[model samples]
Target: MSDSHVTPPPPSPSAGRRRAGTTAALIRAQDTAIPQADRAGSGEPPTPAQAFDALHAYCAPALIRQAYLLTGRHDRARDAVVRAFRLAWQRWPEVAHDRDPAGWVRAATYDCALSPWHRLRLRDRHPDPPSDPADRALQRALLRLPPSYRRTLVLYDGVGLDLPETAAETEASTPATANRLMHAREAVAACLPELADPAALHRGLLRLGSAERSPAPGSRDIRTAGERSIRAWTRCALALTVTVAGATALTLETAPTHYLAPVSPGHAVQGLPVPGSLGPLSRDALKLSTKLRKEAGGGPERLVPQAR
Candidate 1:
């Protein structure tokens, strides 16, 4: 909503780099800070749109880097962030009211980026290796970890989250998460002996992230996409509801107002005009009619019954 609270990342890669997960202005602007004007009187809360804008501006850049670490592919990382924010915007009520809006978005981004489903995509199948040999080695090691283990390692080590926090975010018990983190470290150590220390592994992960440029979509772009998605879904639901209602109304209009007793079938009488039309003749009736016609119309054989 205002530029004072929303400071963007340093423009150029050459400008200066901080450790991963450092957003320049986020520390001061934490938890959707209220403006002086709002805080002065009435204690009015910022509108949903205002709150969403503030949250996105605060979280997006750092999240982009984290997503890059989660998925090595730049495009996939970008898509995951955009998709996550789009979802966050759509579910703004739940996200805005949550204790940690940033964490909610982070979890969504991680889930999207870490999904095994991305591996099936044709273009993303090939690996994009970093130019630096050490970075390349680390990337290979990270990829080798199982999705669960990989996620746990990134959360606990790379993002500076505690064991319980990582466990909660990954939806795993703390003990299981600890096991995953331990196994992940061992696996990475097997690849590169220098990363044996947890601190060194953390630095390695950050270096790997910084080496690759994360292509996170703009906050405005994500918000617009979310709004467009909501509009499409709303229109679809409305159209379906209208169609059902119209069908019901049409059925009601054409239906009978009252009941009438059903009538039985009728038979034909010779030389007498029936008041109403008779039902269609059966095969035997038609044949008998043909035989009677071949003889006299009023013959005694036709009138009298024969004893078998």
Candidate 2:
């Protein structure tokens, strides 16, 4: 409702380039800080710490901005990124080998930011006063979109991910992602007509980015937070596993047992008789059986039968 924490107007093109350069520099600095063995092209993947640092430096700021756009809260956005990176740290071995580890973190942030758990907390926080009418309008428009469309827009346009990358991050097919992007663009354009132009849309997003340009956490802070999160997550997982296993065992132990005794041959044959060839009986056989039954009854005499 308010832009109290909203980012300022978009920076000039040259200033945007400078900002991009600074981000790249931050990433480079973090990369170089890693142990020699963990450096790129070292024929070995970075250690968890090294990988976490690299990913956080490169992705955290953008992820925070994206999450903020999704949640409309700076604190929630930061928490989402932190939690996402924590998970990435826990599974660093797998993440380190990923072709786009930053994308993985971005996807996780998306999930965290939009989680239903945040809704109750959001209700408790006071809404900021509206700073700019345009910013407020854009925020309302984005929030009005369904989660899927909103996430697609954030990942593709806000996070600067390509269509395929966005689809992969969103776990949707490429064609579906393209359709979603088109729909999302149309929706936003409907609300903010200037976004009808592609360049204007990008510029609008750039302005949003410039408004809330917070720095990422330091490597040590990320490491500490990540380790704590991993430990808590591991404990929960283990407890859940144990609970499920115990429940399963208890159910099996307390279940009723039934053993059927073998049926006698005579009793077994009490139902329909099996056919010799497992096929339909012929008309002749049916007629013969009926005649034999009639003769065996011997109830009535037929004069025609004697002549025959």
Candidate 3:
């Protein structure tokens, strides 16, 4: 990996053209999040950083809220959004060209927030309940529901995504999404009878989602961290490649060049020392030779002496 800093390239012309049709006001974004100096040249498409800033500014809050509804926790919700944007910045070109950039980020956020691993954390094992009694009950109901069902309900009802869109985002068929939504609504309504009506349930979800607000991350930091993450992974891959190449070289250096025939097992040979046996004593060698001469033409046991 090179030590040189690399700037993210500008979006393609097609992506830039989308910005012409989009206005910050359309998304109800509060801040440009980009400094005046970072502004693009007149009539040119916004830079990657600028586009990311605009997207982050617009979608983060809504995604966080939706995440809170999905996970029923503030910290997890915030973390999910931050991680999603970091991933978006890492794959800036894909995200920039995506038909629904917010949806792309939203999918990533939901996956992060709903990961089963988070449930294992001591911090996340138990979260503080909302202050309002109704909100508290609603969140508990949402938490009681299964993860897939909870996600479906939140995306469909809380985020107002149509059935087909929800199904696509959740990667389930439309029928399956509808089934989960139905089950989830039934479960929530079972806990809170007053929310039996769909409109009332939607309002309940909105109240629960809006009960808490986690701060949105700065786009600049997210981009920097994304780049840093890429650099770190690149370094790790380089180090692993170098290690593998070094190991291969070492093996080649020590390996035998030609095959040697194997010694047959269980074969006996005369005058060969036993494995791990020491050399014969000097006095014993002479005595053994004399004994052998005297014992010639005798029993086989007398022809050879024990090595010891």
Candidate 4:
């Protein structure tokens, strides 16, 4: 048998542009689908649900691409984007009210991809080797960089986020963000000499960014996950309420009651004397006893008032 080799076709120049146009169209379509009732009369944004749908349609692909660049795996990237979107849906009101919902989603996606909860699972799945020389080199170089540097590069260059926005997304001070970007560019350029020029690096990243086109998660899956999250949170709240109520009830049941004690020994009058049964002095003593009993819980042994 003779050995044979086949070469893949070159990527279309228009593919990236087409994808961009399609994403915009999807957003427009989602906007058009929103019911008129969902919009406010004062030109405010649509309802959370409508806003979420539109934002998801428009930004999901780009978010997946950004995640893929960060994690270097398509499956992990998709999972991260899905989880992030689910969270966004749950916090739709806040997200809808944000000045930049897409930026919020991007930040959430980044956090999801790097969350410590996935560390063990991520370790179990080995990454596939890149077939392209350029990609292999870039991936290796990226893997060598710390997460902060990698994220800075991916956000600023690959995702086309401006410096301040990139800083906000990464939760870094602006100067720190700039420093990281500078270091990342130098590192990547050293690894891939062709990317030494700033312009070339940006162009290369844009090209690489456009190559990722993982399918957006279905609305059904996102909705289901959002519902599950809501149910879990509600169950936790109910459990807490029950626990607090039980503790309060138990404490109340076991708590002691208090009573006032007698002010003096043998001063509590047992009964009233019969009329004409006592002398004048006895009658005066009885009147004093009644007054003392009214002032204090029990009558004082001495009827004389203390001098001020």
For each candidate, what TM-score against the reference?
0.69, 0.62, 0.76, 0.66
What are the runs in model 1 whose C-alpha is more than 4 Å off? 1-27, 30-45, 248-308
Displacement of the residue 9 alpha carbon in candidate 2, Å: 27
> Please, what are the lDDT tens digits per residue for candidate 3 over residues 1-308?
12123222222222223333445452444245555565545745567887888898888888888888887778888999999999999899999888888788989999999998996798897866889999999989998999999988877777766676777999987767777777787798899999877778878888887877767777788889889999999999999999999999999999999999998789666997667867767897988777766763643565557677
Candidate 1 residue lDDT tens string, 1-308: 23233332112222123323443354455444545665567767677766776777777777888877777888888888888999999999899778688889999999999887887898776667789999999988988888899898887778777766777999987667777777788899998999888768878888888866755466678788889999999999999999999999999999889998789789866897658878999999999888877765445475766679
Tens-digit lDDT track of model 2 for 117-199: 77677451443313667777777777878889988877666656666666787898777777777777889999999777656
Which pairs clash in model 4? none
Name the candidate that leads on TM-score.
3
Task: Show how many residue pairs clash in every candidate, following the order shown.
Answer: 0, 3, 0, 0
Error of 4 at 32 (Å): 5.7
Worst 10 residues of 2 by lDDT: 7-16
lDDT of each: 0.77, 0.70, 0.79, 0.73
**Residue by residue across 163-244, what tens digits does model 4's lDDT show?**
6667788987777777777778779888898987766766766655555677999766797889898999999999999999
Best lDDT goes to which candidate? 3
**What is the TM-score (0 to 1) of candidate 2?**
0.62
**For model 3, what is the alpha-carbon lDDT of residue 159?**
70
State the lDDT at 226 in candidate 1: 88
